[model samples]
Target: MADEIKIQEIVEFLLKHGDGYDADEAREAAKQSIEEGQPVVETMCLQMLAEHVLARIHDPSWIISRANEPDCEDSELLKRLLDSGASAADLALFARMSQREYLSNLGCILDGAGLYDTPSLPHEEFRIFAVNDEDQPTAMIDELHESLGFSGLETEMELSRQAERDSDNAGS
Candidate 1:
């Protein structure tokens, strides 16, 4: 059987480097692990550190639909529904309903609400899975893939740059 995994070491490593990767701490951890005959522990700690950094760098919104514009197709459908006599409760239901059910009832829901002119608004499913897998000490990549709900996903790496750009755009 494999050596028992060290939870305290992993937690300490995560707490020390979860906000960002620290080369010195990583090196020290590796050195200590080697001295203590725990090479596997060192490898696990490094892998976890990399995954934590990746998750922090990527924007969660990149996986979701952009906010709908007021005059966009969906909003127009909503407007037409309101005009045709759909109650606020109906729209609220539409907003909260599952994507599959919402699409299935789209036409009837709109028509019954008095909206005949507007086209059907397309819906996309967005799932965000944040997992802390307990089976492996260095399961960061697995957790990230599970959280992202996709395999081999590409993500922007410059979060700070993106934030700066967003602030600039907002100010202008």
Candidate 2:
């Protein structure tokens, strides 16, 4: 039996550090793919191992469409907080302790109500991986492939990244 956690780790490694990498996204894709139970997701992992490991080239198709989901629910008080003169810090604290129950492990909520664009992480920096298979590419893939192996299969790394919500602030 393949260790599902290990597969998630491999999926994350390829997306975060592999050829056409996005340092920010790999984690979420790791969780989603496992829960999603989609073959395309697995195929994506295979593709990443097969190609990016060998050739550091990017396929335009690799730029996939993803939903721009808010990491957490904005505080019911978010508007009030903003209205009352909460510093970004106040907002962050409120969000951390309260609002972000869903993706609490991912991080606290930093953007909400689309009032302004938050393009970066502030003050604290955090990076986490449920597993660290990043050190050895061939070894990691070899181990996973032999057990849950699929050879000669073309696939894409079913990775995902959360981008800021509409800058135009549409649908506010």
Candidate 3:
């Protein structure tokens, strides 16, 4: 309910600013939104801002264009996939990349979904962390990498795995 109101306020602000406002104004507005407990709204505003400002860059044609120019490894790889006719995996990854701004605009869904304040577990409950799906850690990591381009996921996975290992060691 509160989130919905925040979103409405953001929409109103955007409508007022329109697309003609200066970048600084947009940035300041976004900062204010986040500071006011509306991080999700702020993220949505930033995503819209990117689309408005960067629409001309890396045009949608990149999906069909070949790479002939020097660029970052990721961009070059993306181009190669496009030129070679993107595989299902590649296409999924590409879609994820494209929708990243929007998903991030919704705030950190993964973090928000985690059981941050769950009650204590029973004594018999051994400390074995499992992901939502039945996938092993590596598979989950890969899916997350494709779904969200956060470099920190791998680091977080490592830490989680280490913690599990430490717990098992302590139990033994």
Best by TM-score: 3
For candidate 1, which ten residues in a row score worst on lDDT?
A: 123-132
C-alpha RMSD (angstroms) for model 2: 21.1
Give per-residue CA lDDT, model 2, range 1-172, as digits (tens).
Answer: 3646655675666575556756445555555655665444555555555444334223212111111223323333344555677654544454344423423322233112222234554433322222235521232223433654433212211211112244235556
RMSD of 1: 20.3
**How do the predictions measure up, each by TM-score?**
0.22, 0.21, 0.30
Candidate 3: list runs displaced more than 4 Å.
Answer: 1-44, 50-58, 62-66, 87-98, 109-172
On the 0 to 100 scale, the lDDT of residue 128 in model 3 is 33
Residue-wise C-alpha lDDT for candidate 1, range 124-147, written one tens digit per residue: 211122223542233222453355
| Superposition TM-score, candidate 1 onto the true structure | 0.22
Candidate 3 per-residue C-alpha lDDT over 107-149 given as tens digits, one digit per residue, 9 for 90 to 100 = 3443334233345656233223343454323222235446555
RMSD of each: 20.3, 21.1, 14.2
Residue 43, model 3, lDDT: 52
TM-score of 2: 0.21
lDDT value for model 3: 0.53
- C-alpha local distance difference test of each model: 0.45, 0.41, 0.53
